[model samples]
Target: MPSAFLLIGIPGIENGATWTSLVFCVLYVLAILGNSALLYIIKTEESLHTPMFFFLSLLALNDLAFCSSTVPKTLGIFWMNGGLIDATSCLTQMFFVHCLSVIESGILTAMAYDRFVAICSPLRYSSVLTYSLLRKIALAILLRAIALIFPIPLLVRQLQYCGDNIVLHTYCDHMAVVNVACGDKRVDNVYGLVMSLFVTGFDLLFIGLSYSMILQAIFKMPTKDARQKAVGTCGSHISIIFIAYFSAIFSFLTYRFGQKTIPHSVHILSSNMFILFLPFWNPLVYGVKTKKIRQRVQRILFYNQSTFPPSRH
Candidate 1:
């Protein structure tokens, strides 16, 4: 086994990598700023202390970790030509990249459940989603991700890479790394497929079910205004869910099925976008769609402004 693996980073687009790095740099900065602002707002605003915002805070933190795990190394590979990642570090990155992805999926599912309870069982919302339960859910998400993803790196580590050591993607993606191995990899392939289906398929199924119930409840409301309000409440969550899952599904399918028809650079870009799209858009979606967050953000920006002219003037 080689000591380190080299990442070629967006094959067939080497010359444009610097420009691509600039775009990724901008998006990373935005993701950091947006999610950090979200965390700060949720932390400081007493009124925002509810199960919904609590889940949003967790999402923000996860987005921060998720984007951080891969973007820096991606930037290094693109700008600094530093793509040589030690085998252990490569596995470690692969683990976090996949683990955090599952964690994000779990968080989104929890958010879906929160909305389901809030809309469908409003009276029981407070009792059903206590902070204690939320904490337990958060812990379960962490443990579940660890349990499912831990074996992935171990499986990859067992492989003997007697062939090329260059990873085609920017980061040490699990399948990308596994594909570089020279020997039998049926177990790794099956495991990766099973885990992806289990995590993504399971979470997506629940999210869809939650929304179906939510919609049923909304439609059952007699007053049109009440129904609209209920739908409005779910708009941001729905948008975010769509963004997160669509990018993920697209990337997954493209990698698994479209490898022959799809251009390599397109696949790499889509994969990178899957990692970046949600983090960049989550806060923006919430800040614009959630009234309280929008109001709070406005107040924070214009808190010092006075309606009347200064007496000295």
Candidate 2:
């Protein structure tokens, strides 16, 4: 039983279609297993013990969280008629969403910094990103995510809603919930916009700059193979980054910039885009590009079999 109730167009607790519910079930299954596999791969592979992989594993963890925060509820809503979530459950969903959003933004920023250090000061890469230092940086990202997100949830919890409980979206969101409040919402809206633009916008600029330096480094390299490999490593990251940012930007625009004429379904679509695209793409992106991850996964599987032999006679 969820504490928060959604005020969606389906009216009170209407049961969604069977196929839609099934689709969500399938997606949730894949999302959990995919991210779990990524965690295992990074942990098992000693060779994959690099700054890039470190950031990636964190990103994977966040993706798992990002999906976990909403997918379960969304599926629940679809599976049950008149899916009724309690107020506290709604708040929890919003809190986790904010937390994961903060973390993903921080992880992207750290990844850009990692690329900057790797490209701009190649000589100091090892010393700058030593294992202990990596742990601290990761902890910093986690702390920053929690710190940035805590305020939004706190603010939301303070408000009193006066019966406009039909949340247009399937899951709880900061703005969506805040919009239902009888209290003044302008301040919350402003805070939301500032938070959104600052974190995502800032990360995008730094990522762009990182690629600029990386491109220069590639051109100055003496051999084609070196350049090719460098570009290869960057390709998947660039693709994933583009997709993640695009979905985020689209959703942000709809919530902050778009007019009422845009309709509820459009908003739902944008939110869905943000929810599904990154989780599905991110694991594939890093898992495919990173060599150590592959090797480690292989070892994890091999060792698992070795340790637990089949019951054959």
Candidate 3:
């Protein structure tokens, strides 16, 4: 049934050739390959098994699952008039999308805490961020995400979608799907927003606050290299986080408060951009910021060079 579900929309209305469809295809490939590679690098490199990279692995996994669920369906709809997505498939997408989203936000907050202790309380960093603690945190994250999102889609199942299931966007997104409900979605929206704010929005605030304190701590520390290293480790994360949450907050606010003037194209683009670009940026920015990944990449290149032994000059 999931495979048989139809995505009725503008695409269903008898039209063809959307440039964005191609873009979504490219996005799907990048999301899969990019996140897969990140996971590979982390798994192969034992040194990367720290709490920081552990969370990185979780983030990568979530990205892989999250992107896989939506992009392919969207791409199919783009190429064909309308892709069939059964109600089961739609709810599944809704569940995984929100689940991954919450996990990503939670992991980011945990990483910020990791940074805080690493910088603020270096001597106690290892003890504070023990494997058991991280495992607990991860379990907490998973449980929280599951708890928050599972019901919304189940609630959706109860709604009577008698007609007009034509969603304008590529995939079965939350607001898009919920809008078709015959009953009031106000409770659903409010409840979901509360969870999102606590899980994602508030988490972002905490991460930022942690970084602010870290900045202050760095300034107080003597030695340029220390200051540079501390700040540099965070700059890439800060950049990626800024892009991710800015797009997210923009999309959320526009969906909620900025709907009047927000063009459909703008609304759609902003939402997809975060998931599309942010996932790719996570591994990339971390590779740049962390010396270990750069070293591993260099070694990989060198190993390939040795294997082929470049043509004699």
Candidate 4:
């Protein structure tokens, strides 16, 4: 085990530290505030007590946890030059970051399935997605994420870190950390590739299938209003799914294959941006597109408007 690992923050852009830190700080603030407000509204609003909103609440919490794992440490590195992370802390960070990612993917898949069921068999949707079933789904998502990535830290821990302990990325990425270790990393590499493919690829494939089924069901509806209503219900979720997956996929591709074409700092920055952008934008996307959430947010922000002197009646 290494004493501490140093994170090289945004290599080749040393002068942009303050600017980078500012952007990160802003994103973190927005992500925290937005996710918290969404969670609060969902909890308090009886209208949002359905399975869709319940799944959304879980996603908000996951986004918060996901960003929490990386952004704070990243800020520490950029602002205070607090780059050196102990092995235990680094592994812990790695675990949660990847775990939350898997959880997010699973949640997205579950949401897609929810949409599919709602559209395809509206009559059975309520009975099919009971609270008990949702609990089981949540548990299964958590367990699957944990079980798949549980070996990552353990595998990395067995390797010796005699070489340069400096990590190029802002946070303790599993691959970056493993690459620096001084032992056989074939298992780690293979496992990582498999996990990445399975989690993202599998979830994405299912999401696509679910939506395809959903669209077919929507098209079969007799009226334009019915089709539009069905599509509208899925609009926010589809946006979130695309944004989150796009970022994650871009980051993954860049890290795995963009070293030659993409500038190192550019790759690093984009990777961090993906981590921050998803959580930061998720609430805004949902709040704007989901009419009920939008209305509730408006009411909460303008709680006193109804009592104003506009009632000159």
TM-score, one value per model: 0.96, 0.87, 0.91, 0.95
Candidate 3: worst-modelled 10 consecutive residues by lDDT: 8-17
Highest TM-score, which number? 1
lDDT of each: 0.91, 0.76, 0.77, 0.89
Q: Which ranking of candidates, highest lDDT first?
A: 1, 4, 3, 2
Using lDDT as the measure, which candidate wins? 1
lDDT of 2 by residue, 258-283 (tens): 84756666676567657765777788
Per-residue accuracy of model 3 over 182-211 as CA lDDT, tens digit each: 677777788778876887667977997999
How should the candidates be ordered by TM-score, best one leading? 1, 4, 3, 2
Where is model 1 poorest over a 10-residue stretch in terms of lDDT? 301-310
Pairs of residues clashing in candidate 3: 5-84, 5-85, 5-86, 6-84, 6-85
Give the deviation of candidate 3 from the true structure as CA RMSD: 2.8
lDDT of 4 by residue, 225-247 (tens): 99999989899888888888887
Q: How many clashes (backbone N, Cα, C below 3 Å) per candidate?
A: 0, 12, 5, 0
lDDT (tens digit, per residue) of candidate 1 on 48-147: 9999999999999999999999999999988788999999899999999999999999999999999999999999999999989999999999999999
Candidate 1 Cα misplacement greater than 4 A, ranges: 304-313
Worst 10 residues of 4 by lDDT: 304-313
Clash total of candidate 2 = 12
TM-score of 3: 0.91
